[model samples]
Target: MKKFNSTIYMSGKYLFVGMLLLALLGSCGNNADKTNDTGKQKREQLPAQAGKEKAKTIVFFGNSLTAGYGVDPSEAFPALVQEKIDSLHLPYKVVNAGLSGETTAGGKSRIDWILRQPVDIFVLELGGNDGLRGIPIAETSRNLQAIISRVREKNPQVKIVLAGMQVPPNMGRTYASAFRVVFQQLAANNQIDLIPFLLENVGGISHLNQADGIHPNPQGHKIVAENVWRVIQGLL
Candidate 1:
């Protein structure tokens, strides 16, 4: 397990370096075919705590996968997680902050706004786009580290879950291997929870994915929810 021994902060120098190193695609545009849900999936609002009573909150932050791009919002894993939370009577609220084409840079820019209120758990699910585009691994790592730092800085007690992702091996064994290592290194360096493979048992499985072969379908999301639930149960 990683050790959390230091208070985190975003170093301006590092952010400036990361910014200079990027020529990545636009953030608000559509996802690539692998990650896109064909732009046909209808978006839905997540479960809300109607009573207005105060409860700890968990936020799912990422791109298409987190957005449930090709599936109903209710079928998203985060929503599934909310279902579990409610059924178990856990004292927590769920917020899904996913966007179809969001990258780590986009996420870093918007994290503070998302942290407007206290959050008990923050699940960081980004970097897939970075790997897909073959952006500098160093830049991807820095952006994620900044995100994790900002989250901790905002809520010192918040538990962070870093979701690991993989690009096709066609990206080259060296690149693919390095990309996978990025998440593991971050998890260890930050001492946060890690989901080794976000698409475990689902990736490369035709039946579990939409036509895109990138984003998971509703059924695939059920397994994704299980992947996350196992790690977060103790924290909750």
Candidate 2:
């Protein structure tokens, strides 16, 4: 029998085995990390994408009136709107981004953050604070304009609703009159939806207001909800 060349055969076998293992290791390296990263990306993106599809939001962005300062939040007009939506089996989400004492300028400054997400219907309920603070009428109008412009710029398809608000005559007939007109001008200028007066039948009614004569009582919010619902019903 011929003696086998053990060194050559053994070296060839070992080299083949080594190369196969090297290929496998190179292929498998970081596969788990890659899977985790891809999965993480999917997890991160899924909720926002889902929210866009699943949420039909109405944002009532304003101040104390929107906040329900004198009553439970659920008793607020925005919350009442939500109740109506839910009762009617409407697919809508209400975001009450109402900050107490928020002025038109404040709303303007912070509105970019408010609009970071989807807004189907944007209800502008600001400027009352601007009026109360005796801020210049032109400045109030300009700030409100900027806020509305930003909302339109952010979501062109967003249906805007301007909620008309009035300041007391104590500010003098001229200032008070001009303040009321600001909202009318904005609603016409933007051609957006209008809630003629957020506090219609609720504003001056002593029984409807809290002691502050500013924030509404639960009864007051009910009237407000009606005002809003009447105007926005067609949109829904």
Task: Write candidate 1's Cα lDDT for 1-236 as tens digits.
Answer: 12232222246556666776552443333346435554433222223434455789999999999999989999999999999999988779889999888989999999999999778899999999888888889999999999999999887888999999988999999999999999999999999999999999999999999998999999999999999998889898
Q: lDDT tens string, model 2, 81-188?
A: 999998987779999999999998889989999999899999999989888888999999899899999999998899999999899999999999999998999899
lDDT of 1 at 75: 99
Name the TM-score of candidate 1.
0.77
Summed backbone clashes in each candidate are 0, 0
Structural similarity to truth (TM-score) of each candidate: 0.77, 0.77
> Any runs in candidate 2 off by more than 4 Å, and if so which?
1-53
Question: Candidate 1: lDDT of 130?
Answer: 86
Q: Which stretches of model 1 miss by more than 4 angstroms?
A: 1-53
lDDT agreement with native, every candidate: 0.89, 0.90
**Top lDDT prediction, candidate number:** 2
